[model samples]
Target chain A: MQGTVSVLTQIKEDAVATPVDRLVAATAPDMARVNELILSRAQSHVDMVPELARYLIDSGGKRLRPMLTVASAMLFGKGTGNAINFAAAVEFMHNATLLHDDVVDESDMRRGKPAARMIWGNKASILVGDFLLGQAFMMMVETGDIVSLGVLSSASAVMAEGEVLQLAKTGDVSTSPADYSEVIRAKTAVLFEAACQVGAISGGADTAGRQALSQYGLELGIAFQLVDDVLDYGGQAGTLGKNTGDDLREGKMTLPVILALAEGTAEERETITTALGDPDATADQVSAVVAIMNRYRALSRTLDQARVHARAAQRALEALPASDMQTLLADVVEYSVSRAY
Target chain B: MQGTVSVLTQIKEDAVATPVDRLVAATAPDMARVNELILSRAQSHVDMVPELARYLIDSGGKRLRPMLTVASAMLFGKGTGNAINFAAAVEFMHNATLLHDDVVDESDMRRGKPAARMIWGNKASILVGDFLLGQAFMMMVETGDIVSLGVLSSASAVMAEGEVLQLAKTGDVSTSPADYSEVIRAKTAVLFEAACQVGAISGGADTAGRQALSQYGLELGIAFQLVDDVLDYGGQAGTLGKNTGDDLREGKMTLPVILALAEGTAEERETITTALGDPDATADQVSAVVAIMNRYRALSRTLDQARVHARAAQRALEALPASDMQTLLADVVEYSVSRAY
Candidate 1:
């Protein structure tokens, strides 16, 4: 436990200019074009469509998914411009899911601001999310890359299924670790996998290169989500832009909760079960649950699991030729897990 | 006024077996294959997806859009099986929108049954709708017909815009006839146009043939929605599946409401404003609004407009080679308007 804590502290203390910052700088030009495309495509003749779409789009998400797409494309020496469309499309898909997920979860804050559904009403949110998806496909079609479209479209379906499965499992205290993995894979990691794969395809990756990037993406996505689950229980509100313990309040069966539930005594289990899915649960109640999670080392265990995936993500890159982009990509994967500390 | 009433009565009395029944019989074999594809495509590893999708798909909505797709493909006399995929994709798109629309409108009844949202909850409905849409795109991608995919994706964006525009205009009595036309064209007719256009393209239609079929579909779709709008105010609940005045209760600015609001006296306008969007409005309140609509000939005028578009649809078919399908299709258009009587 001391070793694990020291490793996390070392990673945090050593970071001044993080890999994400470097990656963002490395991919700024391509991302500029991607950003332009996203804003341009979000425009609609209906005033409310753009209004709601921009409200969410311009909100400060890390834009990590599209950045991954751009970075992956850059890793390949072949400079195909089609990655621009693919990257924008991937971001649109992510935003579309976020809009719908917020509505489904009845969440209030996104990126430290009121959610799109909260501002525009669920009807507008649903419609604009739909419009963005349609535009995403339209942009994909315009690129004439049927293979990339297939990857993304299939990912879109899997993501929705993941959300449905998550909804079904919400508040189910008996939800297993396996169920949580399946939920996050479907809802989160699949898009990440698709984004990287599509980027590799656009950059003229061979079958092996595509497969390598896809594996990297899948592992990185898992690590990213595991860390997110940890943050939902352990991170600060200022950094998260969302309140801590949101997963517990929403009854999301994330890794930490699943771990704690599995190890908790009967009394600790009672403490969690009472607060789980209780929208009005007090801050003190949430802290009590978090304390129980600490008692079981659930949060740290989840981070340990994240580190495993992050290492796997780094290993995926070893299959490719060594390049500066590859090293940065590896660092980005490490940063994804480390930042949660 | 007397002549208009007699014409409506004569059309009603002359109809024994409607043209829709004949059209359905004509397309039964193609429709069988489409139904099979739709059912198979709706399947998912996620149990709730199929459950909710099947509930809506199996509901009795006449499957008119897909039927049109099949019938249009048959008109070209080249039997390309790709139409089967396009037809199924079209229906999936239609069903997806219906799911989202029900959530947006907070609709209680759909096809004379409880809405999918009511049974499955809004979260499930929204996610399942998204899953259906993704499946729809996957089906289109499977066909490798980028042209058809382009058509459907663009129509999807347009339809969403239409829905948002209509939502914005809801309960706003100042909404104009032009606004009503734009709303229905975007929300309803665009899909109709795409269904036929894709079918014609798949059937090896020449440029002229494709344009003709596209025009025919657009006009027919306009007529279809106009008749539907009138039915929401003037048709019987038993025949319409949904209740008469559902549009009114939902604050929809359909043609009848637009026309009546435009022409009604101040007192009559007051009567409508009170009941419009009042979910708890009694049948008596609805009847009073219907009576006002009659006094202004709003419903009749709307039907007259539908007749004009229905005739234009038949004219568009004149550009094609004469065949049995053409004649039946023409009768189908006539029946679309006359059935409302």
Candidate 2:
């Protein structure tokens, strides 16, 4: 219990250190625009088709992806509708991803409720996700920014390829960190980079500025995902949502677990690897793996790496002109590391 | 045998007759631009995700949506990258729809090949489709046509809602023809409308030209879809890849099926209504339903309606100045009616 407390304490510190909150705060204008777009655009959908889509749109999510998009755009300097569209587009894309992810994961639960796949069925979830994706694309097209469109499209393609690669690699225990990064980059970070890059381009940043924001987003996305994975084992009841160590029970090879398997004692490694091999591993087995991970301080090591990436992400923002947007964008970096679960 | 030959002869005549061939020829220039955009815009995706995305894209498709976009643009006397992007965007949207459609239908098939969901698993298929959707939004953003983007996004939302509506109404015998048309418009025609609307906007068409092309697409899309339903029952095997009565097997309610359900004899209606309820109904039941539809001359009625829509679509073309592209677009209207299964 003491050990878990220390881990949680450390996460909170890292998350509030600097960049994240500022970045988030600086995106105020974009946020307002996003609210307008969400209300107006979603209401328009309700007008045309009514009810069904509104249910999915209104379903609760933190709207993290869209915020990231707007923040990234603002950090580039000024603001525009392209960023607004990017924000909404990213959010729509994220939601579409979630709907499909729930189906693919065959996860019956998400947050504290039954997954959309469970309530709506895999078929409805999948098709509705497709429709949302179509909506996302259409939003992007309306932005009329070729560079922005090009980057996002390429990101999307990479994201899908990465997803397919991960699917092909599922249930395999021999996956490497490099492979995992490649997969996550496509699955999670491309959009992050696209959001930032789109923002930078719209802000009239030079090539260097765009590249820096893109780098920041890429690294931050990886760090965010790493922290999220770590939370699967390390989080408390509230933050973790479902069961602690749920990812292991599902035979997921997340960072700490993977690192622990590499560094743990022979017996510990065997048990952990065995659980990964067994798709039907119980919660006890997952918890056992979690304990072993803690013993090796694998979670700490993973956190250390995430912090390093987060710092790098923060540093990338140094190139941007100092402004309220820049400060808020920077603060977001800190906040990103703070969510333990 | 005589009846089959006569039908085959009619199919041959349909293929040869009307404006589709001429339309394809006229739209060649803009379509060429569409091809260029595919190579350039989808360059990164095709390069990075070639292995994953090539499978579906290379699969046989008519490229009709893209043609609508290019044709609409050319009709307005503006041949620019906007039209090309719009064309590519529509194609991307169309493919995304098909990917999800196969997943929802659970048929494990598409155009005779194993469905993406079947071959790659639902997870990969679903995610990749999403990636394409993002790619499309990115394309729209790059185009910098806010109005067109709005149109595309709106269509995307409507399309999703349409699918959800269909899902909700599936296997329910009381689904009205109006509701069925709603589904067709949302799921299919919206893309067509966007394709043409984008084309006109990108091609520098005046407001009048844009409105005309938009109307043309709306009508053409409806006509095309109506004709498609008719072909599902009576189209030649050589052209329409799937077996006849597939829609009936799936319990879908297209216009012919809906009209037949409305007009058929009590006994005939009961047989179809029963088959619609039983998802596992036998091949013989499917055949029986088709026979009942034939007895009701449902396809004839549907064909007549399609012709009317085709003429209406052609009327929209009259706003365009005389050009090969305009003529070809008009040709597409006639071709839509005559397209075999």
Output the number of the lDDT-best candidate.
Answer: 1
**Span of 10 residues, lowest total lDDT, candidate 1 chain A:** A1-10
Model 2, runs deviating above 4 Å: A1-33, A44-61, A68-86, A134-155, A194-214, A235-242, A249-251, A261-274, A277-279, A319-332, B1-49, B73-82, B139-147, B201-204, B235-242, B323-325
Encode model 1's per-residue lDDT on B128-182: one tens digit a residue. Answer: 9999999999999998989899999999999999999999999998898999999
| C-alpha TM-score for every candidate | 0.94, 0.82
Q: Candidate 1: where are CA atoms >4 Å away? A: A1-15, A78-80, A235-242, B1-17, B78-80, B236-242
Alpha-carbon local distance difference test for all models: 0.87, 0.71
Model 2 interface CAPRI class: acceptable
When just chain B is superposed on the true chain B, each candidate scores a TM-score of 0.92, 0.87
| Chain A alone, TM-score per model | 0.93, 0.85
Q: Can you write out model 2's per-residue Cα lDDT over A74-141, one digit (the tens) per residue?
A: 55555666788878877766766777777777777776767777766887777666666666666776
What DockQ does each candidate score versus the true complex, computed on alpha carbons? 0.75, 0.41
The sequence of per-residue lDDT tens digits that candidate 1 reaches over residues A1-341 is 23323433454456686888777767777788999999999998889998898888899488999988887887774324889999999999899888998999999989889898888898988998899999999999998888888899899889999999999999998889998999999999999999999888888889999999999999999999999888888642213233877888898888888888899999999999999999988888888888888888888889999999999999999989987678888989988887786
